[model samples]
Target: MKKKTKKSFIEYGVIIAIFSGFYFTGLHTEVLGFLQRGILATGLMDPDFDKDSGHAVNTDYPEADFSMKLIDSKGENVAMEELKGKVIFINVWATWCPPCVAEMPGINKLFQDIDKDKTAFIMLSVDQDFQKAIDFNKRKGYDFEIYKSNGGIPSMFSSQSLPTTYVINSQGELVLTHMGMGDYNTNEFKEYLKELY
Candidate 1:
């Protein structure tokens, strides 16, 4: 009788231990999967700064004043002049471009990190349908303002390619223009913005 009681106690202990191990393992796996998803979703997860390609030309950016119509997600019209006294990042992109889609989250991250009172970011969609641009902004939950450029307005800025970004200083001078997608939220880009102020 004493031997049977001891065997029964040992069997219960083993069962409890196995159950605890499985429970902890399943919990850990779930937590790790959630962390991985979070990292992949946010642009701030990585700090890799891509160097500007040699093709970037340091042309003297001309001082120009132009008016464009920006429609918010709510369909309200915002004028370009209303954004004066703020550093503006004007990105020209189309929804179909893969590089443009890839660069969007970085731009959104940069917009979120900056001082909003002093800086303004605008994405100008070259898509034919303005509603598509509005939908994209809604789906992405982007914080930056988006504008739909008129037919001749984009040509005035000398933007020849999709995913081009122009950084305008506080004084409204077009300063830096990048041809392709880049890590706009990097420390180096922030330093360049600091110089403008």
Candidate 2:
């Protein structure tokens, strides 16, 4: 009888161990799935502007003469020279970039609220598919002039990352280059724009 009781205890122990293993495995899988879904929902795989480590570009690079064709929301061809004599904010972005999408609405609002007669906001998409940019702008209902960088306009400006922006003075000189997006309507940006005029 003693031996039979010992065997029964061991058999129950094995069953409990197997059940615990399966339970833990299932819990781990659920946790992993939840994490994956959260990342996809937030679009966190795209590049982000690290505000803490970001450095401002000094107005020291030699003036570069570059021109490109821009397509408006209505699919009209516009020359870059049309923006001459105006303080221009040129943004280099891509549709797949999350930070670019987030900053775009703020830039649009800035354009609408500011004195458009003096300042012009230029959005140049570096996406390989020009149609993707057009579709994105259309879905977002954006009003800024969208352009394709066919002549390497982004590389000419020394942009190393997506969503880079350059502030040009009225004299057609690059004054400031921001590696990341900031508050476009803030006093800091307004003051910077005022310097061009």
Error of 2 at 24 (Å): 29
lDDT of 2 by residue, 1-197 (tens): 99999999999999988767756654433344334444434543322222311124335543535476667656677777888878778888877666566577667876777678888887888788888889878877877778775454645565777678877767776666667544464555565576666
**Model 1 regions lying over 4 Å from their true place:** 1-61
Q: Which window of ten consecutive residues has the lowest lDDT sum in model 2? A: 46-55
Best by lDDT: 1
State the TM-score for model 1.
0.65
TM per candidate comes to 0.65, 0.63
Candidate 1, pairs of clashing residues: none
Alpha carbon deviation, residue 174, candidate 2 (Å): 0.4
C-alpha lDDT of candidate 1 relative to the true structure: 0.68
Cα miss at 9, model 2 (Å)?
A: 29
Query: With candidate 2 superimposed using the best TM-score fit, by how many Å does residue 89's alpha carbon deviate from the native?
Result: 0.6
19-89 per-residue lDDT for model 1 (tens digits):
68856664433344344445445655332322331123334555546476667556677777888867777
How many backbone overlaps does candidate 1 show?
0
